[model samples]
Target: MEPEWIQAMQEELQQFKLNNVWELVKRPDPRKHNIIGTKWIYCNKQDEHGQVVRNKARLVAQGYTQVERIDFDETFAPVARIEAIRILPDIMHSVCMCARFQAAPKESHHLVVKRILRYLAYTPTLGLWYPKGSEFDLVGFSNANYAGDKVDRKSRSGTCHFLGRSLVCWSSKKQNCVSLSTAESE
Candidate 1:
């Protein structure tokens, strides 16, 4: 029987191939083009009491070696952030993406990831709860941070919609235009 980690890796690769995640092409000349390396990350999912619940493996592109224009174009991806006093999967995805983009995600990124993992372990069964026959009122909340991103000097805005105390939709994104004032950003 195959080891659990190996089986998990095989499953991940199989899904990628089935989904047409990438195509196989002749290796580009080393002199002209830079071919990014790939790595397999193995992790064990743990429950609230620290018991191993599942074995997981992920194949990730080595983004550090990638050049901005030559290897990839844009880094912006739509991410959703919901503020319902609970941690959701979208926040984890966002954090992972952010760590991937960092040129050197050394200690700080590792610490952040570990913190998130610990939080997940502490709340394994937590999830959004929407009671039936609850109030049907739709409420929306939005806020913007002026020049939140120091590197780009762009404002960031986030909005969340609630349907009777249950979060339905949410989005957090950097503003397209630079805001001149806090009022404009808001």
Candidate 2:
């Protein structure tokens, strides 16, 4: 490899080491374990004038080759949906439930309302907590309780957005239209 590329790779490895990104493991049997493959990517980071300022190197997994069930149950990607500004509730599922019954609250709804009030009374200072030096990465999650509402037969969808480890935004709402299948609800 060229000296510049080698230097970039070295820098990348140094950063990983400092961060304690992974640990060395003994080689597993080929028959029992599906070892993940990795690749090295190199690029030149540029300034506003399009002048190369620094060499960048990245070590990445070749995830595409892995099978579904045998390799993993679920895979996560760091992505944010620009269109969904207000999304899932890490909290306030009860509050959302109360809102649904504004027009006609039942005895059960009244009990839930009282319970919510009691919670508020006990934990007056409770609120969204954010720590110092939190990461800037945006993470979002969404799931639905299919046909959960007995009255309307509508699925309740909830979503939560986070900036690093801190909760940023969330929402819990009943679907506008009824969906027949679980996949359709999602």
- Top model by TM-score, which number? 2
Q: What TM-scores do the predictions have?
A: 0.35, 0.37
Cα lDDT computed for each candidate against the true fold = 0.68, 0.71
Residues 1-186, candidate 1, lDDT per residue (tens digit)?
349988888888887787677899999998999888999877788889999988888777786554343223434332111111233354434454555548877777777777667656776676556578779898989999888788889888888777787676677898787645554553
- Looking at candidate 1, the ten consecutive residues that score lowest on lDDT are 78-87
lDDT of 2 by residue, 1-186 (tens): 788889988887887787676899998998999888889988888889999987888787787554443323343443211222233342355675687689989999999899878867776776655567757798989989988889989888888877787665677788798746555553
In Å, residue 66's CA in model 2 sits off its true spot by 11
Cα deviation of 177, candidate 2, in Å: 40
lDDT of 2: 0.71
User: Which stretches in model 2 have alpha-carbon errors above 4 Å?
Assistant: 64-186
Off by over 4 Å in 1: 65-186
